[model samples]
Target: MAAKTWASATRDGGQSITTTSVWSVVRRLIGYECFETDPEYLLLQSIYEDLRLYFNFFQPVLKLIAKEHMDKKVIKRYDGRAIGDHDTAAPPYQQVMAFKDVPFETKARLTNLYVQLNPAHLRTTIDAKVAKLWKISW
Candidate 1:
């Protein structure tokens, strides 16, 4: 018999299920920059995966610069109208830190990492790696 996967073994009626939103964003981020060519693609899947890791490493830095709107609360009016109360636009890192359930140690670690990142350096590295990948594909 095949091994039962977590999704198949769960009984929560898909309430605990996750979506592909993260990957969809990643694909959109890299689609135009990395995969817009009509020529042959990367020779191996591992190469593409490795390149993705490089992109992921610097993604948080980009997010720090581009603040996103986050809905913190919802209010229902007497007239049955609903309104969303959003937190001031903030980076994903800041939003994560605000969550009550996140451990203090985790927050401290993330803060340490965030402070050390150099966006200019990361961008240069990403551009260099992408150019190398393009050279390989051609």
Candidate 2:
């Protein structure tokens, strides 16, 4: 799904999109760290695109470690005021697994993928790829 669409679907009222926040991190890695000058920056469009593809490869693994805060309930007062109560933070994988409507086979597939992931290794790979981009930019 497109990041904006996903964000719109999941975000609470008046809350900022998490995907937008995450994109800033991507921008810092690719834009700020890679290019040093305006002229050089224009020449590195291919590199930027390549690095984006590389980053996306590991993005899901990175998200495996990111905790998402889930709201459990909205408590309504006599005056019609409502407050959201959050549940414990969990990774997206766990949240999917916790869903009653998710099919058992689908959950099993996710579990299989989850077991093969190592967050430390994924981070190292992302760092190495970003460093590679830095090298190519110069």
Candidate 3:
């Protein structure tokens, strides 16, 4: 996983900077900057798991679903970050339970679909007729 930051200039002369009010940054980046909280945590990714959100969610189920079809180690190598952190390495039971609104069950797969809509899409009318959709072959 790539580690990136919004404001990652804390390292200087191999020492951790406690404050971001350095004269160099004021003259260079923002011209002037002030912060209410520690910019390191806010602007910089201090936690390792910040990048692996979707990978972590799907990691648990991959083993349960794909073990017979694929190698587990190879799957981890592709889907997982180099080092496991609080997010990616966390056990599935608690994380699955943390999901809200929809009913979650132990023996069933939880399928989620997210849609991004424009105002034009909303203006289009719905078809109203309800029917079960099976596989479509053309």
Quantify all predictions' global Cα lDDT against the true fold. 0.47, 0.50, 0.30
For residues 1-116, what per-residue lDDT tens digits would candidate 3 score against the true structure? 22323445664444332233223422242223232244432332222122123223333532222222254553333224322333244424335656575475541443231123
Model 1, global lDDT: 0.47
- Pick the lDDT winner: 2
Tell me each candidate's TM-score. 0.45, 0.46, 0.18
- Per-residue error for 119 in candidate 3, Å, reads 26
Which rank order by TM-score, best down to worst? 2, 1, 3
lDDT of 1 at 106: 89
Identify the runs in model 3 with alpha carbons over 4 angstroms from their true place: 1-37, 45-49, 57-110, 113-138
lDDT tens digits, residues 20-112, model 1?
Answer: 325554344345333323332332233344434444444442222333345974444322322333324445676678799999998998888
Cα RMSD, model 3: 18.4
Q: What is the lDDT of residue 23 in candidate 3?
A: 34
Residue 112, model 1: Cα distance from true site in angstroms: 1.2
Report the candidate with higher lDDT, 1 versus 2. Answer: 2
Clashing residue pairs in candidate 3 are: none
Candidate 2, residue 113: how far the Cα is off, in Å: 0.6
